[model samples]
Target: MSSDDPLAAALAAAGLGGVQPGDTRPPEPRIEVVSDDPAEPTGPRELWPEGIGTGVGSLPGTDPREASALVTGETPEFPAFPELPARGVGADMIGRTAGLLVDLAVEVVPTGWRVTARTGRDLRRARDLLAGDLDAFDDACDRIRPHWVKIQVAGPWTLAASVELASGHRVLTDRGAVREFAASLGEGLRAHVAEVAERTGATVVVQLDEPGLPAVIAGSLSTASGYGTVRAVRAPDAQDLLRDLISGIAAPVVVHCCADRPPIRLLAGAGAAAVAIDATRPAFTGTTAEPRALDAIGETWDEGVPLLLGLLPGTAPEREPAIGDLARAGYDLADRLGFDRRRLARLAVPTPACGLAGATPDWARRALTLSRELGKAFADPDE
Candidate 1:
């Protein structure tokens, strides 16, 4: 590969050089290194320690209990840990979180549920931290940044699921509101991506975090006042809206669903560069789960769409396969599924099935380190 055309190299390696909307490409075949920008200043401090709450920025204006009830089949309270300080310094959360995130960016693994932005302020803090992140990523593009660094934003569905309109209606119910909010989100996302590029100068893979896509499609989201389920919107409109929302960003986009019922066909058809599923979540990789997801995965891979398969279990260390074993296991599965192992080497990024905020800091760090090591082992198996 030449120095000037990494994108071409990535697309060619991933079997996506000529594929189109209808053609499924083969499994992934490119490896990415993350950028390293360490000079940015530290952001605000966190009030709470890690591993204690529902995570930062759970949803801006909704009742957590209601949202959880719909998804978990259980009653819910506001999952935010209000007791924890939402702000201060010496907070290692972002740094520690980044270490875990970059480890699994391009390599396939189960990774979703962002804790980096635990509160509204955390997002602003992230902007501050990005200076360092970008600087670090740009300075050592070859050493730290992944060939495809995955950057996430709250998805429209989840945004609709979590955010509330001023009139107390679910955002999804109001097409206008959803469009406006998504547009705003796109602006923030572009800035985030630009910062990443400024720091790393490599391809930045933007992943939209949507846990409520299934519910939104099924018309299950309730209004902010808890009146009733929001009306379902047409698929074409949703896809078009999302496409516009994602416009202006140069990097390939991936829609990530940690929840069951990811709108695979919709996302695929929506022109998303890829669909990232939380393999650790039964909603996706369950033994008795629907075959459509697998078929979709295969189809997407064949169409040159990369799948960020999250194979690591979601719980603590006790529940997941060892990092070494997990990498080998995924490679084997990819081969059996007709994907070339080399493609798997590039397409797969090893990660925990979901977010690690629920795990101890020690566990989170370990998971990240293990992911990097696994990538190394897979990349140079002959060694």
Candidate 2:
């Protein structure tokens, strides 16, 4: 590798201090939280304007300029950081997140992303792609300055579950490694949030996307060999690491799990300012939903944690549903759970059911528009 290749040189230092592969050193001190107090979602309603709408990140195309413009124009009230996974490797959720780690780096392998001895081309590309996306986002918001902008990152469990350690096993399989990664992630995210806030002139609210959490909790994810299953991560350990990360973020944090049965109770208890869910998911549908799920939702609302309700489709449907039809899920849940429907207006934000990277350009735009409309309707249903 040439020293003139600035990106690779910078990333090599991160992965292993530019030492030849297979060297080792202690990670920087574990980042500590200001307060050890119970992390009680320090901000939800306070950070979010009631009923505002946003996206779940990721659009179909590779053009960050186009994707950022769409999000900024359609949901100007609350724009989302655009992610274009179609750009490949470094552009995907996990790869983009790996770019933010302080002293940790991951290289794409034939199997998947794996920890490496030195920074590889894949790690540099990941950082480069994400930097380009952020540049595009910054340019899009050059004119209109929204007070709040939402950015997504892979949560600890998801990150641990996705990346392979040097031993060829998942990171979560090693408790010590998991702690180090979590602490490094907290440090990296805080720095990222600060940079975004400075460039965008808006308060950055982080959404930790945990689509892999359910699998981790259920011990359903396959091992590297595909023969055995990883032991289920205990609820308390997940919550504690999450709480520690959240407390250190300083910015308002939202935990998003679009899985069919997101561990709502554990997330709410972990001190997120808001909990984002796919309202259209089956586990959240009427009576078919486990009673505990409904109870958890009710309890979350009662506790005043905002819900980023994903009421619209990630991909466009053959028949476009009415706003009322799309919103029925939230209404029915509240009604069945015995809460005033009006509370949703004050405590919910509308979004697409998931990332729109798979959606066509038309559906992606339409979904953002629908989300904005639902926000208005949720805030003022009579209209």
The prediction achieving the highest lDDT against the true structure is 2
Query: What lDDT does each candidate get?
Result: 0.52, 0.88
lDDT of 1 at 156: 70
TM-score of candidate 2 relative to the true fold: 0.87
lDDT of 1: 0.52
Please write out the lDDT profile of model 1 over residues 254-324, one tens digit for every residue.
77776766777778777777676666555444365456766766777676666556654444555555656
Candidate 1: lDDT of 20?
Answer: 46
lDDT by residue for model 2 over 133-170, one digit each (tens)? 88999999887888889999999999999999988899
- Cα displacement (angstroms), candidate 2, residue 23, comes to 61
Superposed by TM-score, candidate 1 places the C-alpha of residue 166 at a distance from the truth, in angstroms, of 1.4
lDDT of 2: 0.88
Off by over 4 Å in 2: 1-45
Model 1, residue 20: distance off in Å is 53
